[model samples]
Target: MRRNTRRRPTGARRRTFAAVALILGGGGLVAANTYASAGEGDSGGRVQDQSGGDQAATISCPDVGQQLTDVPGEARADVDKALANLDQQITEAYDRLTSTRQEQAQDGNFVRNSILGPLSEKRTEVIGQIKIDVKRAGGTAPEALDGLAACTEISPAQAQKNDGGGDGDNQDGDADTANPGTGQDDGGQGGEQQDGNGNGAAGPFAADFVDITKVQPNVKAKPRRTGDASTGTFSVQCGVNENKVFNTDNLIVAPGVDNGAHHTHDYVGNQGVDAFASNGDLANAKTSCSEQGDKSSYYWPVLRLQDGTKEFDAEQQGGGLEGNVGKILQAKEAEITYIGSPAGKVVAMPKFLRIITGDAKAFTNGTANANANWSCTGFEDKVQLADKYPICPQGSSVVRSFAFQSCWDGQNIDSANHRAHVAFADAEGNCGNGFKAIPQLTMRLVYDVPAPVIENGQVKNPYAVDGFPEQLHKPITDHDDFINVMDEDLMDEVVECVNAGRQCGAGAGEQPQEPQQPEEPKQPEEPQEPQEPQQPEEPQEPKQPEQPQEPKQPEQPQEPKEPKDKPAPQAPQEPQDEPELAPEASSADADKDRAKKPGEAPDAPSEASSAPSDAATRTQEAGAPDDARGGETKARTTSPAETSDTGVEAQSEETQPQPQAGTGSLASTGADLWPAAAGGVLVLGGLVLLIHNRRRNMTTN
Candidate 1:
């Protein structure tokens, strides 16, 4: 069987390849351009509104919470002190700007020029100070702190550190760390030149990059509460299939829609996928998951195997990320499921609800990174070292899993950015303070990497995924997103499945019952086209109203002209390609395949109906199952019993390992390794590792 390669080349070949490939592509190129034009480039190229007259410039710094997570106790005080002063100045400036007129608050140029721009400059100055304190404390500054300069919507000093204007290696042409909060750089930063903040310098494109250090797996020891019992569960066997699970850019901007992913990604589910998919489009599109009613879409980046080669040369391609492209492979299975119960009665989801799982900005960050998951398929209990990609046993595939937030804000199905309205359930499966518990959605991605081979009695694995060698150390580019475009009724069924605690998919305890076949209804007679020869008889009528009515009758007959008109002009068929109707038609057809009896009349009478209810009925069963066990909405505030499949259960604190405290002795050193390795030990280990990896590759190949 074909497997995705995870092996990476070492020694001379690896170094040679790294030397030649164009290192600036994706976010790196964007960072470079940003710095090159730092003195001249305006707020991310956005035209500044000349409306607001110049007010005294104020500096508004980013919130400390957004920039750093879990700072060591010893450093938090200094970091907080720096942020406090910066924020105070920003607040004063903001007050001044908004004191005279509220409109000034909305002015982009005014905010950037008077507020954010100054804030960016101040931010840099303070970060430099923080670095001093860190050094004084005999520790290295955190990457999150370094990324503060580019945190604003518009940063005039955006490229200061990346463009070789700041202190240290970051200013010496080394790549910066990824932006805080986001694992990858923002859209404009999609390149290989700079790493965004202060992570490291650019290396070989195909060289292994491990974004995050190995943290304890978030997996639970036992099932834990995912939702309250007051609300009944609804589950959908969102299929193992994929509509377009390819190695390309695919981000869901709206339900059943996508914002073209500039970086390569793995897409699955909805077929009406594009940059402009709306809720209606998602409602209409067919899904590739289980032949069930749920049609939510899910996707993430594609994991490839770098075979010790620089697949793309940036200089040859005029300098771009594609010049670093490597061999992309297909994942074995992309399983996505939506399981949740409504708080009370199921209401239609507010249209176009968007949500993301995992941190995109922290993908390459070593501290507090939540995005990377490393383990062999079956031996999920055993996590490999974060610095090294796992060499799986011959049969198992490499797995990258993503679990999305389930708790909803009851009031709004979505928020401005699509994330504020939804949140992850706490360890007890209870919703956060203001949010209410809803269904949880979890997606699992599995890939089959080439098996290890034995060479001269040594086992070695040498495959790897393509990544920015300068910023990342492992193939840790994993993130997932979802847009809930489910028809309201179908969503209700998903709620029912979750509340009942009944498993509904292949892995779930219960098998998905085949949808009962609905008998076909009688077909209506086709309306014939009105004959042109009959038109001459209409004018003979004496009464004007009667004459008009006679002519209108023919027009009504023309309404049935779709069959003749559409069949004659094939160009009209293009409308079916529109997300509005084609998705529903195809999804309905898929439903029919599972539920409609042979020769049963399709729901043709309602074909012309544009009502969501009409279309929803065709896709799901008419009634919810009564046998499921769960209470109606209760007022109990306490957490409820645990439920959902093995995949949907929440992880309790006992199961989740807490992070260790203190920067410790290692913080003073550059790397996360326990201690500096002696030369002899390093050389011996490298030789053994290289030999082992090479042998495994030789045997597998």
Candidate 2:
């Protein structure tokens, strides 16, 4: 009754109630959409989404260097410096982005207006300078380069998509198709804890690692060997930067700029290598290699453990100040091996030829040139991860292997972009477009550090490779550099050993025997025919006369002794058998002697004796004409005996035969003789039967 008197259902009151319900429903829908967008763009455990719907995690710009394929040689220095400056600008911008997170949280437009705007302006000016430098040097600048100046912010999900989604598939189509760990963060520790470093930008988050044991085997089978394939490998024994040679300078990328890499590098080989080093300085520098002739410089990004330890470069631009903090981990083993091509025999690498394997900016620039190969020692054959770092088992060490481009352009030691001069072989191991195959430099770096613990999406004592601050110390950005400063003689040896299909290096002592084996077969073949008849006659003359005369003088009437002496003919056959076993025994003894005396130069003499003895035994087994060829066979057999006694004297004599048998065609003939000798034995047996039958027929007549 009271309501009926107070309000008679006015049209205004009804309209207000419906409007309020509509506003409340619309606000709930908007909140749901915002939360959905944040969840959709989450980058596993790398970063947390901001309240802004379209938040960005990093910056991505077009690679200007990839576009300038034909920069003039004269403009290279200025262009290189300018390019480095562009990198420096991006690093600075990234530094600012990390330092101003609170400002970004307060104002969503702060990153775009204050950070990205100034970065674009600076990049535009540097791009203009690059174009001018090229034009002044009589080279046409790419007009589209101006479009590459503007950069854009990208979400973490977008960054991962650009990098092949961390699926471990490289440009070669080889993939580590393992179910990587659960790449989800529980959102337990947000903000600074997300990156391990207090900086919000620099990171090697929990999502970046996968347990190696769980990874499925993904190593692609090597291309089958063709007739022209260079199958040998040459290893250089440069100690694993034991001298603590560390720097942030990249001589190959930025010759005159200090701290150009913006991350520390571990250096081995040429001791004088630095940003300021000239070609002459490199040539004169002392080396860390066991071979003094190998003065080549080899370097790669240093691995660091994020355990709150400050290093010598803690306050330096490329170290702690740039967010690459912590204790540097020296490689337990840094093995540098140069392998031959699967397509054809590799040519000698040009002196001072610069090679850079893997892209250092792969995180932001995309994975077009990414060649990172990460694994554990025991799991290398099972899985080679390109994007994620491997979590090794307790005893297994972390391994990073880089297989460099095997194809060279033949003309330039380096290109403007530092990549045009070299290229990777195809999946079939063929170099296309007239590219010549060169030694494929493969570097294997092993670290013996404790495994980092990842619990509830939080990583404890994480380890990462040094990289540009914007790259976030990603494993995909792992790279290596090399400059061939090897002396001409040493390089020739490497080429000869590789092309000849013989593994030769400081670590391979047995390789000397391979070359000698080919020569041994040829030497015995040439000297066998002429020396055989004379050698047998010389020894038989003394033995036959002395024995027969002694028996004849005792009994002249013993003419029947001639028949009895028939057994004596078999005595020569026994000596032939002894010669076969004697050389082998001598060679074995020589090897033992060399093994026992470790101080002696074992490679030269041991190979020399073993090779000739093997050749002599095979020749005797082939059944050279009896006592007629005995003297020559005896001479060959005695050589091993003499070598076993005095190694130095034997080496002097053995050296001459090697040069004479250098021709491969001649060496091949030695293997071919086995079939020829078998045929000869069949024919000789038939003749013996015919002669015996004829003699019996004549006696019957």
Candidate 3:
């Protein structure tokens, strides 16, 4: 049986990658290579790859940014350091794909590309296929998705051009590099990059991280249940080298830190949680990072995983998490944390979206308007909690904004919407010893993988993509209770017939059962109807036997549902991590924050919410982007610069008037947008349906 092939990166993304190559590299045989490791002749600070290992050579790019001149030690280390961090990510991803294609698993042994390997051998193949486009002039920069929203349309000419190029070939059309205001090839733009005398400017996307999505499998693994801890033997194995496991003898032999040990601050080696955020200021060991409450609001934390690879804070979106557990975009070493029922596998969310929840102001728009009821301190009904931060008994308000506000989960903070909280840090620098804020956050490319189906003593996903892995992503951090709840609300209705006799779209509502109840046992009206009892319509083909019914008794005799009898159950609330205390950011800060975007909204409309669906209304108010009815959610609009051709829009409650175009049909949240999914497409007021039957087969990354 044939299998589905992987969705290759579009020429746009590849070409963009190539352009990244051009801006970062120069004076080389290859003009645009995919990866950015410096070559043998590279002299500027990029680390040269001299190992001559199986690793493929990365295309080098010179550091090209407004304030940057020389490559930061960290960026160079990302390419040259221990284990070829970036290459390992790419190659390992492909190795898993090959295994899935070859059907090579046997019994209990699973041969996935381990931590030390590259993502794929196909690196050159995939990267080489990128397309390059040079806009002569008068071309505007196409918009990009915010941390998670999306949109996708092209100019009439580009659409025609794209259609012509759609014959299964992928190309990257990247423009060449020049100064922001000046157009020159004098190699001047390349040197403008930061001197690395200090950390460089954050890239539009995270820097130097690997994407594990290409190897994702469509089928989920049946969660396995191994023996519980009882046997006095507990084995903890992850993508770590044997050296990582603590050995009593080895411990005695090697008690000191090895300068040669894998981890180095400069390398973007780990992409787990926010490891860099936890680092001690280079000044000294005693003066390590002030508690989480002390670090600079703008410091770019490095996320490290249990396996040891890392991701720069800037690259969190696509890099997966930095730790082993709960990290969607993994950064480093980690032991499997919590797997849902059935064990070894999990159902991951489709997107890793970021959204704006609220600021300390009351929005003028309707309640459904993106900024209505925020938990911001000065916003209506919000209490001041900044003073209580750092659990300080005194001067509580003096705490770092995130600590007081609880930006991680909005409840602790003052956000109104749940989807977006705070720009990682927007509060005051009133606190001591903090760095500048960093915000050019963007999501990484990712895909799903199912457990391999077991066939003839082998187990694997039956539907693995031909060139991708059957399973990818370590495991999701959240149980997605919201998804569970939403699914519950729509489960019965999705399969039912609508009043129009059309199949319900997903779970819209339960069909009217009162009229369908079995006919009340009619008192046999004897001969009155005998005249019609004659031929019974000439032996009509037997209508199939009455279908089965639920265990509940007939509805007419049953009681009415009391949907709104009591105050409704509140939606789950997240804790806030920052307080609203600081001065607003500078224009420079605003420029850096405009990069991330949310993903697509559903391709349908929600109906107006009625009293009966008040519970869902409350859900929407709690932070869900959609209303309960699916079609009746609020509408949000964005500037053209804030949206992308892929239909994603990046917006924020805190930032003012960033670029946005067209209304936000963005159901922009997370891979597991459970609450919104249950309600379907809930625009604030009005929405557009972007879906058509024809594109159902088109793939989304």
Which tens-of-lDDT digit does each residue in 69-151 have in candidate 3?
12223332221222123223333443342333113222111222331122233332222221011012212212210111111
**Model 3, C-alpha of 399: deviation from truth (Å):** 22
Sort the candidates on TM-score, descending order: 2, 1, 3
Residue-wise lDDT of candidate 1 within 604-700, one digit each (tens)?
Answer: 1111112121112111110111101111111001111221233121122211210110111223222322222333344444555556656766786
Question: Candidate 3, which segments miss by more than 4 Å at Cα?
Answer: 1-202, 205-619, 622-638, 641-701
lDDT of 2 by residue, 1-701 (tens): 45555656554444444545544555555555556545534333222325633345567667787677799999999998998899899888877877676677667688889989999999999999999999999999888898888877765444333232222223333332122222222122222344344444466765566666665555444454455656455767676655455678899988878788888887778766667778887887667676779999999988887876655566678888887877667564566766666556778889999988778887766555676777765555446666777787765667677667778899888888788788777655677678887877766676766677764444667889998887777787888899999999999988877666555674443322111122233322233434333433332222121122222223322322223332331121111111111132113312112121110111211110111111111111111111101111000100011112243332233333322221212334444344444544544554555556556656866
Runs off by more than 4 Å, candidate 2: 1-51, 159-200, 509-701
lDDT against true structure, model 1:
0.36
TM-score of each: 0.41, 0.64, 0.17
Cand. 2 TM to true fold: 0.64
Consecutive 10-residue window with the lowest summed lDDT within model 3: 474-483
Query: Candidate 3's C-alpha lDDT?
Result: 0.17
Q: After best superposition, candidate 1 residue 126: deviation in angstroms?
A: 21
Hey, what RMSD does candidate 2 come out at? 33.3
